[model samples]
Target: MNIETIISKIKNALGEGVDKVSDEVEKSQVFEKFEDSDDKVAKILDDAGKALTSLFDTIADKAEPMIKKTKAKIYEGIFEEYRKDGSPYGETHEGFMQWVDEHETEIREKVDDGITKTRETILSGVKKTQEYINREVSKKEKPSDSVVDGSSVTDQKSSDKE
Candidate 1:
């Protein structure tokens, strides 16, 4: 039965014990308090879950268009840079295939040029990084003493020992 019906039954069952009615009522009130607290906890958790989901959806919605725009800009830049020699690439898949077929030599040259430039740039950067690292390592190394004709300390010591 429902709580109110159970409470009413309890009250009726304890009729002559009316002096103890306050104790029964107190016990029921405590149980009702617990039930109310549980409902509040559940509602708070549900609200927090909904709020987090909404926040995630909002972030995704905001990012989608910007990501598309960035991708478009990168493609545009690549096309503009590579097609500077009046190439007839029309920014479509069919057009691109046709252009490739028609200007195979020019396309190959441009591709090779791009590859060469990229390799040179990477190699230059690597060389500079290596030089900087070597300089730093040399600076950190201890100075050697007792060097004769550009020989290291270990070699000199070994000769002396021999």
Candidate 2:
């Protein structure tokens, strides 16, 4: 559910908790935020590509095999160079996006796998932390004397101190 629906529910539940809050919530607008620096970089790269293609086409002789070969070699050198990670065109965000787009299914599967692994790791850590806290708390809580006697432990400890 959107923030508007949540606000509406809160408004009805609160009834008249704060009329101004309800009115402000009713008039509130939600903005969609994204961190798509990659997309912006991709767009710039696409513009650059168009510019390069335009330059290549400006050579009025369009039918020469040598020109075609040279263009293909240049394109290959630019887009097919293998990076340290063994991925072609992975050096640039735009090129990496292109490679990912081409291998979308594989990349998506790997991403899902990574998320699952990460979730499992987090859950394991949380469980261990919870167990550690429980153990520490149990140690600190020393079996209350109240369990044996009729009085509470705090009273027993205060009486013993006196």
Candidate 3:
């Protein structure tokens, strides 16, 4: 199945478990004894559970695509290395060792390039998300300010009437 489907299944399973536990806790005698204490305890448990769930969701969201990309790159690198030697494996034990030794620099370069590109891509995405959020916040604030300004004008007009 696809990553999104897998993630959704995981989330649903976790949500069901959370709901079951919450229901059990709500039904307990301990919760019946002290209403205020039960309220606070329930709130704390709910908040902590939600936070943990969110953390796992974030991890899964980030890891799925990264794992796929890394797997593809590793396969590509191995295949390309094999092709260069003109053999599926290697010519000989010594030949394999020599190939590895010779390609150390190139392999390192490719890994470094991949890391740099991945970092830049993640950063760019974060920047774009931040910009979008900021734009939305500004849009919301402008309407709020307009409402306050209108109220102030109405208040001043009333004062001037007096």
Residues 1-162, candidate 3, lDDT per residue (tens digit)?
A: 764454455447667554343223323443345467446656776899999999989999999998998979875775567577686346665666566677788777877888899899999998999999889988774422223221232344455579
Q: Using Cα atoms with residue i matched to residue i, what is each candidate's TM-score against the true structure?
A: 0.35, 0.31, 0.45
Q: Who wins the lDDT comparison?
A: 1
**TM-score of candidate 3 on Cα atoms, chains taken together:** 0.45
> Which portions of model 1 show Cα errors greater than 4 Å?
1-92, 142-162
In order, the Cα lDDT scores of the candidates are 0.67, 0.62, 0.66
Which residue pairs of candidate 1 clash? Answer: none
| Ten-residue region with minimum lDDT total, candidate 3 | 144-153
Output the lDDT of residue 82, model 2.
Answer: 32
Model 1: lDDT equals 0.67
lDDT of 2 by residue, 1-162 (tens): 977676677668768754566345323231212335555556676899999888777654564776587567644543443343377765776876687577678655755776689679979998999999889988886544544232332536766789
Question: Which ranges in model 2 have alpha carbons more than 4 Å from their true place?
Answer: 1-93, 142-162
Ranking by TM-score: 3, 1, 2
Question: What TM-score, to 2 decimals, does candidate 2 have?
Answer: 0.31
C-alpha RMSD for every candidate: 22.4, 23.9, 17.2
Across 56-139, the per-residue lDDT of candidate 1 in tens digits comes to 899899989987986686556556644674556666667656765776796568667866896799799989999998888789
